[model samples]
Target: MTDEPALDSARKPVPAGTPDADSAAAPWWTRAVVYQVYPRSFADSDGDGVGDLGGIRAKLGYLAELGVDAVWLSPVYPSPQHDNGYDIRDYQDIDPVFGSLAEFDALLAEAHERGIKIVMDLVVNHTSDEHDWFQESRSSRTNPRRDWYWWRPAAADGGPPNGWRSAFSGPAWTLDGATGEYYLHLFARQQPDLNWENAEVRRAVYAMMNWWLDRGVDGFRMDVINFIAKRVELVDGPRPSVDGGSPMGPQIHDYLQEMHREVFAGRGGEHLTVGEMPGVSVSDAVLFTDPARAEVDMIFQFEHVSLDQGEHKFHALPLSLPALKKSLSRWQDGLADTGWNSLYLNNHDQPRLVSRFGNDSEYRYESATLWALVLHLHRGTPYIYQGEEIGMTNVRFDSIDDYRDIESLNHFREAVQEFDRSPAAVLAGVHTMGRDNARTPMQWDASDNAGFTSGTPWIAANPNFPGINTVADRAGERSIFRFYQRLIALRHESPVVALGAFSMLEPEHEQLYAFTRTLGDETLLVVANASDAPLVGPLPVDVTGGDLVLGNYAGADGSGLRPWEARLYRL
Candidate 1:
């Protein structure tokens, strides 16, 4: 602790709206727009209720025409569905529910033929208790694989190992009767945290990753990548987040560096790696992506996404535009020079951006267009969750039992037992902001199961299917799907958006978020109306005659913007 570590400068607070001066080396992630596919809800080949690889394969043509450079597929690995495929039983095998390995290989081949890369989910931090590795590790303390996971003796007070609590609302350590020891799990009991301290564990993970690369995949979307390394001392973390849960251990970074050296370094040109580093600071992130270390190419920062949570759990709070702007700007600037950044508003773990950030009731299309403009035109690689192009909304659940997300159920139980909250109140929160929000079946059309399957869907579809289906949007020239298609095409065609530097024009304004990207002599300006009313602001940087690139509002005839309208100008 005394060394402070060189490159050990003060962690300057990242200002909102500007990229840092030090971020010169971070590659051209700004121009990238990656589409995220949630396999279970994406598409189903057979009449099965679940989506599969064949379904994804059938849609690559749609994605290719959409013009995104990459597709980030959520976990398709073998799992017990404890955390919706995050709890991996096997890293290398395809889940029978999703499809077989041959089908996945076909997806990789097809995506590559279309010049689109693939980023597979890597869940290395923990594995399902059903996984052979974990089964053997937990069998007995004397087993050769016993040290593969974090197993500690009970505390003096008869509590589990430490005061650490799971992210899903329980003690982080679960008791193992056979060994009379408690094993750590930041998530579910089925997902025991891997002991990164074990050289064998690190090697196994690296070997598994190389196997994927050899199979023709382009990169990996590492799940909770930073949590792999635990603090050796195993000290208790700070008091739980307001409703009560301790912070994840601190030593996670040290393990991350080793992971980079052993796994991601040699695959730079052939493959890219993005770490889902949730608890890292900007300066610390530099260490992970620093070219010298080769730990990873970019990281999915959560500062912006987590703002809505406030003092409660992630799904309990409401979206705040001001808070979002602050969070996005900080990360945009903090990693500006030191590392690369991964931008996204909706993912499998969060609610749909349309429902959470914009007016999802009357103006779903307009609002989703606005959210897309704000994130896609920013300084990082934009990621689009499946069904986002057509503006999907949240999944409504009648009871907590109807929900399948472990985290959501855990929170519901916590609210009732700890806060003595009413069941209605818990359900209300879940309705507004649950992980299941983005898990609904993709609305391909108004047909059966929204065209995701001929049979019943595993999860309920949003009731607004008649209006928001992809078929309707594709047929209409002015639909949200078409707007997204144009935006992605324009980004690749315009240097201002693809290679330009980002400069914020209005950072403090409540209703207006404006920025400009300048590449050589070509400059592009993007103005977004983030409110529910009209906003009129002067064009900050002097501009002459300009061509309107894309406008979500009906009145873009040089007039002010309407609510949730986004406009792009080439000056």
Candidate 2:
């Protein structure tokens, strides 16, 4: 909130190309690359259209060879597919769509056997209305479990409790016919927000997490974990929020501290926990991930990704490189002392990085690899979403009927029907910003169905998969997949890459991104030209000669960079 949280008072600024390492305790994940597997689209062993655990298990060898230290799976729990698998019905068992618990156990055992860890998805903020807890809570006014969810009587004139809108659009509070009450849902009406104010709810969530940890899993990637606590007296938002309700609440720390004490206090394995928090700030993230607090290892913040989203996610603008640089640098400096950071560009709910930020058409491979070096070289743990290694592009939907995401559909309807906009114009927005762009089936090979399945796929494979399949890339020595492998290897082999302090070299440059990382006597300079045109820049004048450690362009030498070019130098 203050201009920026002051840097650790004792630390001094290091030179542009110098190493700065403090004697801080480092964890395995700090130096590890995490790959996220969206189970529904990762791979399908059976002939069914949907991907399952067996599919993921079959790909474990591929992931291992990709050089990721851990695999973070999107939720595999039972759900009604309202928001994909985010609306959970049961946390203890595996969803039938994703195979049984035995398959999950098999996947875990095999992953551990390959020296890779498996992290589970933790969706504790809310649950499906079909969940027994919600069913009972909505059954009657005085049911024993009624208080487990947020429920209130309809307004005097018969309406929702307040003006809070659902995250997917429309009213956040849904009317219950039987009980004549309005139940709250930040997401879809089916996903009623659980009352974290209830001690019983917290106990239940912690117990579910313990169950997963006891099952030999590594840890959790908590979904919207910060939205758990609501204002004691639910007040109407001053303005309607796209996703509804307040985020980064004041009591989030208290709830997280209590949850940490109750669940993760005595856990033996060095589990990795990263919360997917959209509305969190750098200062709040510091408290959430501070080592002493033990609430979580890190959090996924949306500042950088949301910079281009004007007003609402559906409305987007051309991304300014300077703005992106500022966002990343702020977090890098803010959490440098007390906490850690999670770096990513693509996820289940976001468009692919290559399409959204980098060039996906002409210089796809170059831009994708450039972005990878930019983020992976940062002072944080980097995550790779499925298909990212092979440079997947955003999807193009022909019609609203082809879209399955609730948020996308709602926005489409409102844009065309309510706002009286042209259907073509609305469709253009959805095509550009919809979550379905990331949800398209993963491109595995050039065979029928892109080798993702023998049968039809639940979602259509990207038409470009033929040129971008994993099989083709893995066979080529100079493919994007191989480049990612080398990047991960560098992070593991060089402690300087993992531990060096981060300082920006050219913060305001439009096409050029340059930064230095320093630890001990080792200093490295990373520069990327995130544009189609060549860029010229000088090497820092600090009497420096350096080795070209890694580069996207062949024989890339000093003084300048080509289009979408990136180079890492060891000084």
Candidate 3:
């Protein structure tokens, strides 16, 4: 197959208002708004300075009041904290820092009782080096768990087997003295990739998944689930695009399909499973979520997130509204028929959308509402990150030493060593795109630690606490939190916005973005001015009579929109 640039390739254009080729087939995610909770930053109830299940349980009402259907916890499982919680130590047990099994069970019960489903973070690609299984695997060649992780013999030149590089920089292999061999890791050295070819490993993962389901947990928000499988032939990938290479390898789908057949199939038809498959294209994603095989319920695509990154691939760039819209349209159209899209802007990995997409000046609130209007009022199951409703911004780190995310630190070092990028530039890039953007303590109020902890938090809170927080927003009728509540409630209550067919109206206009969702006879037209400057554009379609439902600008009536304003109308 030819290596085509993802954005340049032409795809079949999916027409506007066309029903999802199979919308009639029991739409499970039609009215669901997934509330993404980075368990570590959600709320810390134990005063251990770390957020946990107990903290999440204490805030269930807040989520319920926000009108979300489910909570997508980032990862609360036991880990060595190599990649925050992405490196799993145990598939079944909750980390002691977070809480115990009993607390997790109680959390599920409370969430379900409040009509909110709980989806766990499934990090199946790798295991923590400290995990008993990995420890045993590396103990010796003859160990029973030796095949649980990928191990390779040294090359004839006395170097690593392959030229594979880690996502966090450096070689993908780490030397294990016990076996005199190197173990493969796509990410950090402490996170050794699991051998999916091993049937025992597959069985263990499936059993843990079933255990969680049986315990009344709703579904799983799989973390790097696609990485569970790798190209079997183990061929060297292409030359590094930058100094380090592209992180994606080949043949990962085979393992994913087998995993689905053995594990996901038996979880009943209603269970949800969304994969965090970054760098995957529309055609590539089809293989994982094809209706026939059903490997996963949905997949999170990174196209939209790429908008903030500099074109050179290593630096931060100012966000452009046109670029943002163009990227969003691709996913909106690409996945319209084949599979479901896990729509999101701010997650545990990326910076806050309000800070990145919205103007950070005095127009913050208006820009935030504009972003919400643009993201939620579209096709796919929207995932709103915690503290996003209150317009959370990115955390400002003073130095590289102040950062906790391994990826951010690794990139900073690379920028300095390889690219000669200044320390300030590196820190600025980290501020704009670092994981700490989502890792900041949840801003509950202006109180100490932003009401996230009774004591000091593990990470510093974003500086804009006085103007942006849940307490202050909830107190005011015209606040970002209230706007989110209205937006989520509107999606839930109206079929036009939830289950209706999506149609993009104006594609050429830069300032004006218009789309209509039609459900049988009822039609809801969502129009927004994505720019800070006021815009006036032609509405070619006829809407003879309609009532205005919602708008972000003050003077918005039935006909026009102001700067950074949006409106939803029913006709």
Instruction: Tell me which of candidates 1 and 2 scores higher on TM-score.
Output: 2
Writing each residue's lDDT as its tens digit, candidate 3 over 1-571 gives 1122111111122233444533445355656899988888889988988898889999999998988999888888888787888888887889999999999989988888898988888887888888899889988899999999988887666777777778798888888887789888989999998888788998898788778878888788777776676664452443223334334456466565565665555444566778888778888776666555456667988877787677533467876666766777776667666665667888887877877777767677888887787778887788898888988888787888888888888888887998798889878878777888888899998988888888778887777786678999889867888888888887777656665666777677777778787766778887887777767554545555777787776655545567778777787
Angstrom error of the Cα, residue 341, model 2: value is 0.5
Which stretches of candidate 1 lie above 4 Å from their native place?
Answer: 1-30, 235-254, 314-318, 537-544, 555-559
Reference-based TM-score of each model? 0.91, 0.94, 0.91
Lowest-sum lDDT 10-residue window in model 1 = 1-10
The sequence of per-residue lDDT tens digits that candidate 1 reaches over residues 1-571 is 1112212122222222333423432244445688999999999899789999999999999998888888889999999888889899989899999989998888899899999999899998899999999899888999999999988888777777577778888788899999899998988998999988788988899789778878888788888887776655543443223334223455666666666555545443345678887767787777776654546777886777777775665445655666667777777666655566677888888888888888888778788898788777776667888888988888787878777788888888989998898889889888877888889899999987788898888887777787779899889866888888887877676545554566777677778778876656667788888878877655554445888777787656555678788888888
lDDT by residue (tens digit), candidate 2, 1-571: 1222222322222222234333334667767899999988989999798999999999888998899999999989999988889999998999998999998899999999999999999988889989999999988999999999988877656777667777898888888899988888888988999988889998898888888888998988988888887765554333333344464457788887777676666564277888888778898888888766657788999999999998789888999999999999999999887778899999988988999999999899899999999999998889999999999999897888988889999998987788899999888888889998988888999988789899988888888888889998889766899999998998888877776788887788899898988887777889899999988766442325788888998986667789999988887
Q: After superposition, how far is residue 266 of candidate 1 from its true place, in Å?
A: 3.8
What is the Å distance of residue 82 in model 1 from its true position?
1.5
- Please identify which of the two predictions, 2 or 3, would achieve the higher lDDT against the true structure: 2
Q: State which candidate, 2 or 3, has the greater TM-score.
A: 2
Query: Mind sharing the TM-score for model 2?
Result: 0.94
Residue 371 error for model 1, in Å? 1.6
Model 1: C-alpha RMSD to truth?
4.8
